[model samples]
Target: MQLLIMRHGEAGWHSLDQERMLTETGRHQVAECAAQIAASPWRPVQIWSSPYIRARQTAAIVSEILNCPVEEKIFITPEDDPGLCLDALLENQHSPLMLVSHMPLVGSLATLLVDGHRRGIPFMTAQAVVLDMPVVGPGCADLKTQFLP
Candidate 1:
């Protein structure tokens, strides 16, 4: 199985963090990253996005580029628990899946799968990483590649 993790594009500030929308630069960044994935062998067949506006927008851009579909998942929000997120993810190990989420969550989830801990590595906006695993679980994955904008 393969998993792709991505951070949302750059977002404009909003009083409600969830309401923040992507900036033009953010859109371009996502486009660049999406194009990189489209040309790669690891393009996702399905994308799961945080319900936050910026994440959904980022997923939309990648969805368009890869012609993949998106599903909004509430457990992937920035403040959501990574353990819960991992539990939810376990039920969907059917194909190449991409997750579009926020800073801490994206980093934490990636590291949780790849390194067996939540000591996350940094991920810039619109950045993406690919992980290959025989199964979807902690410490089961190997980092395959990363896309940077």
Candidate 2:
């Protein structure tokens, strides 16, 4: 399976954590990233995003561009465990999936998939990483590419 892990775009700070919305720049950033993805060989069958407002907004843009369905998943929230996220992926039968979530979770998920550890790679806002996995397990995936907007 191929996984596209993305950090939500830059969000405004005035709202409650879960309610924070994306800034104008954030929308542009995600749109640019989505455009690049649409031009690539990879095509997402489904997109799962954190329930947070920012993440939902980011997913909306991606779904619009890719013409893929988006589902809000509780397991992809900022504070959720990376292992649980992996388990969720394992439960899904779909391939070429996209996950739009937050920092720490996104980075941690990548580390857990590639290095078998929780130590996370740094992710800038609106950054994305692609992983090629034979199965959903620790250290089973290889980093394919990274997209920054």
Candidate 3:
């Protein structure tokens, strides 16, 4: 299976973190990154995202470009466990799936899938990494490529 993990674009600070929206620059950055994905051979069959506003916005952009539906997953919240997210992925039947989420979660998920640990790979805003996973387990995937805007 191919998994595409993306970090949401830059967002302005808000008292309620979950309600924060992406900035104008963030939209542009996400659009540019989405264009890159549109040009690639990998097109996600399904898209999943955290229910947070910014993450949903990012997933919206990707969904529009990729012409795929987006599902808001409660388990992919910023503070949620990466293991739960992994298990969620394993439960899904979609191939070439895309997940739009927040910082530490995106990084932690990548690390857990690639390194067999939760050390995490740092992710920039609006950046995405593609992983080729033979099986949905730790250290069973390879980093295929990355997209940055």
lDDT of each: 0.92, 0.92, 0.93
Q: What tens digits encode model 2's per-residue C-alpha lDDT throughout 4-74? A: 99999999999899999999999999998988888887778899999999999999999999999999999
Query: TM-scores for all candidates?
Result: 0.97, 0.98, 0.98
Among all windows of 10 consecutive residues in model 3, the one with the lowest summed lDDT is 9-18
Score residue 102 of candidate 2 by CA lDDT: 94
Candidate 1, residues 1-149: lDDT per residue as tens digits?
Answer: 88999999999996489999999999999999999999999989999999999999999999999999999998999978788878977788547889999989988988899889998889999999999989778888999999999
| Pairwise TM-score winner, candidates 1 and 2 | 2
Deviation from native of the Cα of residue 46 in model 1, angstroms:
0.7
Regions more than 4 Å wrong, model 2: none
